[model samples]
Target: MATQAVTNPVPVADLRRRPGRSASLRRIARKKPVGAIAAVICLLLILIAISADLLAPQGANQIDPLKNPRLLSPSLSHPFGTDNLFRDVFTRIVIGSRISLGVGFTAVFIGTVIGASLGIVSGYFRGKTDLVVSRAMEVVLGFPPLVLAIFILAIFNTSKGYSFRSFLLLSFAIGVIIAPTTARIVRGSALSIRNLQYVEAAESIGNTSFGIMRRHVLPNVVAPIIVIASIQIGNAILAEAALSFLGLGISDAYHPSWGTMLQEGRPVWLEAWWMSVIPGTAIAFAVLSFNLFGDALRDVLDPRLRQSS
Candidate 1:
């Protein structure tokens, strides 16, 4: 009799997953050059924001006529020139990053926590609970975010003025404004995960609703949360800048901001274009970076998108 020949079995799941991940990475690396460049730019901006104190020889709010000659163009001493108040534009831009990024992060964090909680609860428990939560979210979402934000700011800042406290209020307002949309997104993800086999198994095994949501639903929805955060932060940053430019946001002279910088430079466009252009460019790059990163992240994280690619 002839001896039987045997072959090694392939780990189908592992083989499929590994190559897909690698292919996705390579695709992102090769195809999305703009995203990669944007990521690098964001990293550099974040670093500059973090190390503003060390990097900026002049304080963000410090006005020095001797060193910062008024309306001076970009040069060695003051790289981004000087404003009308004879303040270093470079220093302002560096320091302003902290405010912009900080507000964006804080607002996004608050929105994520509240939105994810409502979404998970509403999604997991259908019927009355879902109806109530969904309706509430819809009501909130009906209003325009910028308009809502403006209303909230107007209400809060009427008596408080534009102090650090008011600054926090602005972030909170933006967070609340965006939470409904986030909740809707997370709820959709949770609704899908709620009916999955593993979730059913956990339910059969006496897993509490909270436990199921906390352990299974939240984890499954991480991709949406991340994508939302990336995109929302940029939007929030832009909104905050717009508010500041309109003299409704951070008006405290101590904290230098890109929007306020634009406000300052608006009158003297011809004399010192760098003053407005520099900060405007910073705002544009920051927003662009976040949007690019969000798109790249969505491509990587969404299985449907990966399959399509």
Candidate 2:
């Protein structure tokens, strides 16, 4: 009689370790040094924004009555110099990070969630549903995003005074403007995923449309959504700045955003270059960081990109 051979059980620790997948920070850094650096800068900006209370020597509204000190060049005391209002440009710039970053993140969050949800429904249902969503998205896309954002924000600003609510309104407007693009991308991804065998299998097994979307469709499209969001944040930031510069956004009495700084400095540009230059530099740096990080993320997360590299 032949006896069946008993197999030894694999160690739990060994089972946990997947081959060819080293989860090391050093390895990640080596693969994308530029992205890593950009990420660090983004993290630093977040820290500065969070710690503005401690980092900024003056309050956001603190003013220097001294004419000589006002519009002075950058020095050890005031790294970003003073603005026309005698307000510490550095303090405003530091605190402004919170507002700018907040808008970017909040707007993106709103756009992605609403857009992805609609996209999933449209793609999964197809037929009339797809036609409706696609046409709506096209209408949204036809409008210049900046113009649409300004229009939406202006509508909200008519009766309401500036407050935290105003910021929310601005964020929401931007989010709505961004949503159509997000929805289009997500819809395309969902469409592809819907045709896959697993989705068909789920359908065969009598899985509900909602269940299939929640468990399958959503996950597949998340990567593109994230990539889209990262880039959109930069666009949102620029739009906010442009609106503020045009005097259509961000009242100075409430918050001194970088765009407000730019607007304020423009009148005194010849006298004190630092006023416009410093805040302008900050905006450029922030936008650059987002773009770089987004590109890096795409390279890392996209299987096609990774395979080509």
Q: Pick the candidate with the highest TM-score.
A: 2
lDDT per residue (tens digit) for residues 185-275 in model 1: 9999999998999999999999999998889888999999998888887888888788889887765666777888888898999888998
lDDT over C-alpha atoms for residue 151 of model 2 = 83
Once model 1 is optimally superposed onto the true structure by TM-score, how far is the C-alpha of residue 269 displaced, in angstroms? 2.1
The digit string of per-residue lDDT tens for model 2 on 99-119 reads: 777777888888878888888
In candidate 2, position 95 carries an lDDT of 83
Backbone clashes in model 1, listed as residue pairs: none
The TM-score values for the models, in the order shown, are 0.88, 0.90
Screening candidate 2 with a backbone cut-off below 3 angstroms (N, C-alpha, C), the clashing residue pairs are none
Stretches off by above 4 angstroms in model 1 are 1-28, 158-164
Task: State each model's CA lDDT, in order.
Answer: 0.84, 0.82
- Candidate 2 regions exceeding 4 Å error are 1-16, 19-23, 66-68, 159-162
